[model samples]
Target chain A: MAHAADRRCVVIKADVHLAREGFTMDVQFQAEGSVLGVFGPSGAGKTTLINLIAGLEKPHRGSMALDQQTLFDAAQQIDVRTHQRRIGVVFQEHRLFPHYSVTGNLLYGARRENGDLDRVVTLLELSPLLDRRINQLSGGERQRIALGRALLSRPQLLLLDEPLASLDLRLRRQIIPYLRRVRDELRVPIVYVSHDLTEILQLTDQLLVLERGKSVGCGRYGEIVHTDAVLSVVHDRGMNNVLVARVLEHKAEDGVSVLEIGPREQGEPTGRLFAPLCAAEVGATVSISIRPWDIALAAAPVSGVSILNQVRGTVLRCTGHERRMLVDVNIGAPLIVEISRRSATTLHIEPGTPIVCLIKSHSVQFVGALGPGSPQ
Target chain B: MTPEEWSALLLSLRVALWSMAIMLVPGIACAALLARKKFPGKVILDAAIHLPLVLPPVVVGYVLLLSLGRHGWLGGWLYNSLGVEVAFTWKAAAIASAVMGFPLLVRAVRLAMELVDPRLEQAARTLGASPWRVFATITLPLALPGVLTGMVLAFARSLGEFGATITFAGNIEGATRTLPTAIYTYTQVPGGDGPAMRLMVISIALSFAALIASELCSRWLTRRIGAAL
Candidate 1:
């Protein structure tokens, strides 16, 4: 078994073209991230992409390879069976076998004499559920068992197709931590698919954006959001700038906490911003999500403002989407700020122009605590 | 009851049990094939399996005689090669009963197998189970209640079989005579009403018991599988 620290990044390359009734999915991309977030809205062929990758659906023409093994090749007629591909999939619904107990379902696909069972059971906290029947489990418990079952197969690549989509808000929060453990402890390469931008951002920054069965953008979230193709898909979806920040100090009297954000390299400039007081200890890392539209850009730092955060940075790029402009700023970190076009003209904002991003302390929502092994 | 009537009742039970045993494997096989597969002649196969149910039982018995009798085509080869006789014997009575009861067995089991969700089988396949393993583990168990219902139905039908058994095997006392055949024999004689009435009550009671047992078994199975839905 490969440990997290020694596991190399898995590379996935696919050039698929499939046409169904009223829908055609023609996407091509190569991703090398340990967890590549597949982001798009409904009917954007997100599920179809997952099916194609998992060998549940065949493409009309194209080839796909995962780390060196060819999963499918239309010309070569090298389509591997789903079971033989060793790719685990956790579908939106918890597809646990109703005829089996939780332990039976987990071991259904496990290799004989493989000792990963106990480790996986402990990792997902499945000891209490081992003897329970599928129908007896709650929705959250069922989804966790589904995840543990997939992991016990020891898949080379795990495909999560909106594993949290069917769960309620609180239940979704319950499963995200176990998913992080799977990512950070097991070190299995994952392709996390979801329409919720904030949910995907909590797992990984590398993204593959799909729109209407097409590859709109594929790269780091901060760099790809500047493109118009990506912006149009995520503009009204509550897209947020997810940052990894360290707790600096807490001002109990003011009921606010300060966090330092930006590159962690020595001597590099970092910005300080006030956020709502959180229970995390000082010096611990936490993920903060601030909606792009919640940010207001100014030409200069203004004094006596009610907004608690005024971080100055240079504009990297700016793009117009309908009546608004999405400005990318580098305040020791890349952040996408959505402001109206009127403000853009008033401030004479363009690439290379220095600007101040004014944000209220309440806008900074803590998504989750980042583990030390979590990718930035 | 006289020794002759006792033999008739015993023979009827033997014939019913034998018929059920003979048809169990092939009945479920045909039901599964009809419910799951799609071949070119599927419609024709389905129609043939159901022909005995709709046709006159006498006609079915005549057809069986033509194909499996001593001098018949298949029977002649069997007689010459293996020296085995099938017609006008107790075995012929069982065969006739099995053929007449086949349609009911297939109908019940097919409906049950069709109700077993295909998605569960697909999930099994993805979990590294082969097609045969999926059928054994998922499809067969889920369809068990229907299979039992079909078996009981076939067993009841076999016990009451008359027209086909008489035509194919003939009513020889202590050899091919069954409950209905013995009843017909009693009714044809003078002052035979008492014996005929006694056997009539027994047949009705046996059929009722078989039906009640089937209902109880089906209820238990439904409870086991209902939670999955």
Candidate 2:
């Protein structure tokens, strides 16, 4: 709880308990990032947690504070109303007021005189949608309006509770960057709750893992998923290694792009990864998603091989189950490598052992620009 | 038409309009309460509202006459205190009609409000809107079609009200006699067949027109409201 007092970093500190229809949520965590990804399975209290933070639902007993402001404190007998708390929420259903047009919905929460309507309109590209009826907009367009409406309120925090859940894959991909832009431009602390870990991984680095109404773990993905139970959730779903890489070179002739992976906090560039096709401009930081199965471990960089991406890293941890081993390799940011028991034995892999990861350029599932001013 | 017929027709329109206009606010208020709230006596309140619907119209008129008529408790008090007489007058007829028509109005509006998604209101609250603002901006407009339907239903009821108005306000030729009472009076006398037939035809045409107008209006409102979602 004292860690929540970190004035420079932490924005949300919540310790709450609620029980609904036998599913209890007695979780607690302190979120300290612009976007804190909340990962959990079904009935994991993800919605309950954010609803408490937003003041939509009250906890039976607990305290939740945003910055120095106490949102709720049962002992203190303080319970702020939802509207007065000045928090914005985009529900999974995208509950835009059906009575109002796009502009009307956007400005519904702007109680202040100068509502900062222009910024949200421009950021979400809501100008054209202003006069349109809600039914007139496409799924992607409706979500943008919902996001824009939440932003216009100029709330202290934004809770996106599965905003992308109902969207199809293409629509989901379309809305992701707009979400990133909202975080970058508004700098509002966001608690993004999602059942799909893939969306959470794409949204933020820091995560709070909740399972069965308890805080299982809270840290970077590489640290939290190492827990046996959490790893199984990831293993069953076939989680991938996501690399934030800067587009360093684009050889259009060979139809390939060079992506430099894993930007350290304050050090030299970590390693190089590559993506097929001439996608994105040089110097643009892009997310490179690759499945562990797509990567092959090697003793050294194999020369004259058709494979394009190869990086050297140390093995951090190796755990085995059912003829398979999950080798955590620190190639700058930790990446999970799925290998069979045969390869684990043949490679003699252990913690602190240096190894090379082989990945074909085409195996890079995705590559796209993050934002305009993303650091090189 | 005779001067008495003209006055009676005009008076009936006035009574119906007054009845609808006076009941509109309270009808909607009660409907919203019944739709959204649960109190200790919610079932009783609900039954009280719909009692006029299930009971005979003459019975409702008797109740109104007993309570709010000239010599009854409330009416007697007003008569002695303020020299106001409502019995055997157009005002009594309007009150009787309003009481009889309330249930239809409330039922339509309540159903419409109930159909509205609660999540929409929750979303509005998170957007910094107070509950009152949410009702003004979200609830009212979304439930507009039902409200319009209720008002038209009330208006139609008042226009054709017979038993309650006759019992409470009496069958005065010009001052208190509405269209339904006038048609009844014409049929009860000699050499009244010609006027009676004309009034009967006029009554049917007016109701038909009213129904058509209500249909057109509610459909337009429903389309406009649903177009946004």
Candidate 3:
């Protein structure tokens, strides 16, 4: 048996053409360990990218590989069939086999090899529903089974095409944590496709932005979210900064946790960000996502403020949009703060201005812990 | 009823039952081939399978007679090598009925095959089931209702066959005589109405029974498969 560390990367290089409903997709990219979120509008070929990787559709011209194992190479005349590729696919609609019991579907892939089955059932919280028929399962339950089914395949990589896209917001919220859990515990690389920005940001670190069947951008979400080009595509709505933070102290009595933000390279920016105290224990690593619009910048560090987070940084760049001004500040790393254009002109904020970035600590949403062996 | 009427009734039942049974395997084979597999000349094969449905029954009977009659080339070889002479025999009448009933069976089976979800078979394939195994376990079980419907339809069609039966296997008492042929014989004779009416009633009952049986079997099998409407 090989450990997770021994596995290879998934490299997809394709220039595929599919004509449908007056839209065409000509995409190509590759990823490894990091969850590569394919983000785009409907019919932009985000799902098509996953389909090509899953072997559900063939490319017109391309070479795809995983850890040097050639999956598809037009020049080499090699195309491995879907079933033999040792990859698991979770489709948009939960594609659970209606004829089989939950256990049957979960074991469908596992049975192809001789391995322990009980462990998978327990890990996925599927023990109770094992004997239940798929037709009897709720939509949420069906997706859980679909996830478990894909996991049990012991795939080298997994491809999920908007697994939660069909569910209601509450259901999507309910499944996000499970996805994060899977990503943290399992070493397999995942290629997830979704238009939901929050869901993708909450679950994945790496992202591949797609538009009109072309790859527009690819990188860590936190690093790319601040770029003017990426923000222009993201439309700079509620999307903001994703910071790698640690719980320096948790004051349960005050119902707040002090998160250490800004890299040690910048001598820690001299202030703390207040966040939800319930999500973590003291000294645990967590991800804090704060929308750019929620952050307020002032020229002076004011006293008697109700806002719990006040960080001092120098503005690196500023770009004015129709109703808002996007300011990039380098505290330790670049953070994009979206402010009203009126305020930017009134405060006279510009590049190289020393200012205090103020945000209500409660705006921080804490995501899951950094996985073991994760590079901080 | 006269002895002739009784023999004809028995002969019709025998020929229809034997004809349905004989056509079943080939009918399913043809339907499966048409439904699941793609090949060169597929359109031609489909048209050929359905020829009996479109052509006049007399034409099909004439074609059969030309190919299988005792003096025909294939017919002569069978007679000389195996001492098999099908012309004017009850077996020849059964063959004619089977050919006429074939398209009905194939149509029913093919429709059923189409109704089954292809994804189920693909799931089976991913589960490590071979193509043949997938067909047996997933395809055949799901398609059972259609197969049963086809079988009943073929049996009913064979029970009522007249033109093809007479054309290929000439009416002869206790040999090639069937219900329709006997009815013809009685109509041609003097004061034969009583026997013909009784046999006609029996024929009607048999046909009705076959239709009812098909309905019940389709319901039962559909329920057994637990298929959602």
Best candidate per DockQ, number? 2
User: Model 2: iRMSD?
Assistant: 1.3
TM-score of 2: 0.91
Lowest summed lDDT window (length 10), candidate 1 chain B: B119-128
Candidate 3 runs further than 4 Å off? A1-9, A184-186, A226-229, A236-288, A298-301, A311-336, A339-356, A365-376, B1-43, B73-94, B117-143, B170-202, B220-229
Cα deviation of B5, candidate 2, in Å: 1.3
> For model 3, how does the per-residue alpha-carbon lDDT over B129-202 read when each residue is reduced to its tens digit?
56676677677778888999998888888888888889999898899989988888888889888888888899
TM-score: model 3 vs. ground truth? 0.79
DockQ winner between candidates 1 and 3: 1
lDDT of 2 by residue, A148-250 (tens): 8888888888889999888987677667777877776666667898887777777677888888888877777777676776676666664777777778888
Native contacts retained by model 3, as a fraction?
Answer: 0.08
Assess each model's interface with DockQ, reporting 2 decimals per model: 0.45, 0.75, 0.23
Which is the winner by lDDT between candidate 1 and candidate 2?
1
Q: What is the TM-score of chain B in candidate 1?
A: 0.98
Q: Ranking by TM-score, best first?
A: 2, 1, 3
When 2 and 3 are scored with TM-score, the better candidate is 2
lDDT of 3 at A24: 73
Candidate 1: residue A197 lDDT (0-100): 92
